[model samples]
Target: MKGLRIIVTVKQVPDTADVKIDPKTNSLMREGIPSILNPEDKNAVEAALCLKQQHGGTIIAITMGPPQAEEVLGEVLAMGADQGVLLTDRAFAGSDTLITAFTLSRAIMKLGKYDLILCGRQAIDGDTAQVGPQLAGFLELPQVTYAEHISIEKGNAVVRRGLEDSTEWVRVKLPTLVTVTAAVNAPRYPMLYNVEAACDGSRIIIWGAQELKVPETMLGLNASPTGVKKIFEPERKKKGQIITGDPKDMTGILIDKLQELNML
Candidate 1:
């Protein structure tokens, strides 16, 4: 068996727990809020690590953001990724999910051959959960999302994906994309000793829009179709009803409530 080439995408997001919203602007106040690697992305990295260990491969950790985003690349490298790539440029600024995926597709193309691409189900800051599928779409590859387990067998990738009330297994060929959930694995803390080396500028590949070969006109805010009209918390007007009783009684109560709301 040959070693597979894997690319794992990660993100640096504001620690949502400490996120603050400006009442006046009704927008996020991100300044001064400490940023960390997206939590679910840790599981994605762990999945890549485990696959690399089992199949003997190189894992490339890549991210798109400001220079400060390299911290996450360092963490993944310290955790065992073979290489790190930072995709940063003013041309990539203010990109929504669509253009973000487009830029990443171009970057991934430059990264060369890969057996698999892994990503977190969603980023904490923007939970659109669209990038993975969109990336796959741009690359014209098969994709599976919400993956809780993944394995390679006979050159095929097997994935177990969890859904709201059920789970399903999917089998896809290599050169596929899969978005992983936190249930996949517990991420190992980065080796403290390697953190310094991992973050060294010489070790990380830095590429801007020019290196991507994509024109400036096709990148950034102007190219993005989705715009944020607002970012405000929705007011909770209706309280949830609590129905507790035997199965039949509970079912009856639920039906009554649904009927009252004309939702049944």
Candidate 2:
């Protein structure tokens, strides 16, 4: 088989542990928070790089977010991706998974040739796990999700998927998309030289809505079918009553309390 042309979709997200919700906007408060490449996405990149190493191919890493999101592309490049593509625009803000998938599909189409597309099973911030399947639908390509292992031979890709109670192995024709779980493989750290080179502007490509030619109606929050109405931390309420008595009395009291709470 010829060398593979691989594409990996990635994202930049605020560190999940430090993420905060905005009470005023009912959205994630990303401002002033440190951002990093989505953890699972790093696995996807590692998978792509591994395949390229074995098959003599090129890997392109792509992501969509604000201008600052370019940092993710830089990281991917440092990790051995041959190219980095960023899709960013004011209009892409507030995009739900559907719109996000559609926009990514458009960018992939613009790339013209590719033998495989890889994605992380989910983003930590949203944990929706919807974008990969949605992107495959938009691109009209077959997809393998939650893949833990992938092997390619004779124009076909074989994947092992980790499921709830069992594992599944699937083989599909080339030019398909696969969403990978973190179990697939560990990602590599960038070499010192590659890290330096990744910072060079020439290594990254940037595209906005105008370049993508996406319809304005399909680009942002307006295109999203879901909306967050509000966000707030659930109030913590404590209720307790100590049955300070003999064991039998305490048992009886507990039973009564359970009944009062409709447990019986």
Candidate 3:
């Protein structure tokens, strides 16, 4: 694996589990919420790190977000990635999932050769799992999504994937892209020494549309084929009270309530 070059795409998203809707703008106010690496993406980095350990390759983490997203890239470096690239531009704002995938794929193409590309199953904030597969489409490369386990032997790779009904195994060729789920592996925490090194050595290589030499219509607002017309919060429902009693009595009461509500 000495010559293998890997790229991992990461994103910084608001901790949506605790997110709140801002009524005024009909948008999510993410300021106060703590930002975190998308859980599934951490699995992506861990998978790359594991590959590096066994094959002695280099890992580069790429992220597309605001300048502050560099923090997430630095964290990946601290975990032992070789380098990071930050793709930031005001024009990149308001990009939908399709635009986001195009931007990321362009950045990866700019970096040249890579044996493997890894990404998280989905971002917690958007929960749109399209980017990984979209990127594979853009790159014209094969992809394995929702991968729970991966093993590389010789030049071929075997991956176990999680699906709606059951798990299935897939065998893919080298130089492929894989999107991993949190079930893949537990990511490691950075040690004190690596923390210091990452702080000192990590430098994000920033790229713009021009720098990447991508077609103007292929990047930013001009290139994006999709748009978010509006963003709003969905209505929240209140939880119903639970009644605990003798099984026979509770069942009778529940049936009565359901019949009265026409839900039976």
Candidate 4:
């Protein structure tokens, strides 16, 4: 297990769930919006930690965001990760999911050998759900996505992948990439002692396009083959009418309303 290395890809994003768009710039006004670790990503960290606990190994959490995102790295370290890497550069800004995956894959490649890569199912802000698979594609490694659970037997990994109606069990050799979902397990907060250690020793490795040596044509906005055409606030839907009546009467009224709406 000493030679085994597990890398967890994490991100810091604005809590867009409660954020408001700026009418002036037609962009989200991230100012004052709290940033957090993508919730599903916490599950990824937990997965890596669990694996390290069972089989002695090093768990490295990697994130691509602004320099300030080192805070997120400290949090991950506090939670038991050995250390973290922060991929930051002005060129990395405005990256869509494709470029993001490419940047991470390149950084991981520079990080040397690893037995496995773990990532969350999706980032909350983008929700493209493409990065994990895309990184696997770029790495040309077999991937298991939407994993609900994982186990190791000898040097092989057995995973349960969520499907449309059921789950599929897949076994893959080491060095495979896997994306986990929230159903994996509850993430553990770092204890006070570990938190202090992390706060003192966490030095986020900041990688730029030059350091990573990834082609600029394959990074950031230019590297992104797609871009957001438009982003508009959703119109507020009208309040629903309350069907206040006895149970039988409510059922009848619902049926009448459905028929009136031609949805019956």
Clashes of each: 0, 0, 1, 0
Candidate 1 clash pair list: none
* lDDT of each candidate versus the true structure: 0.91, 0.92, 0.85, 0.87
Per-residue lDDT of model 2, residues 7-94, tens digit only: 9999998876646788888887887878999999999999999999899888999999989899999989988999999999999988
The CA lDDT at 188 in model 2 is 95
Tens-place lDDT digits, model 3, residues 1-264: 555698999999886675776776656789878898788888899999998888888999999888889888888988889898998887787667788888888889989989999999998877889999999988989999999999888877789999989999999998899999999999998556766766674356988767777665665666667655566655678888698999999999999999999998
> Would you estimate the TM-scores of all the predictions?
0.89, 0.87, 0.86, 0.88
RMSD of each: 2.8, 4.5, 2.9, 2.4
Candidate 3 runs further than 4 Å off: 1-3, 23-26, 201-203, 236-264
Native-referenced Cα lDDT, model 4: 0.87
Candidates 1 and 2: which is better by lDDT? Answer: 2
State candidate 4's TM-score.
0.88
Model 3: how far residue 172 lies from native, Å: 0.5
Candidates sorted by lDDT, descending order?
2, 1, 4, 3
The candidate scoring highest on lDDT is 2
- Model 1 agreement with the true structure over 17-116: per-residue lDDT tens digits: 5466787765568898889999999999999999988999899988999989988898888998889999999999988899999999999999889999
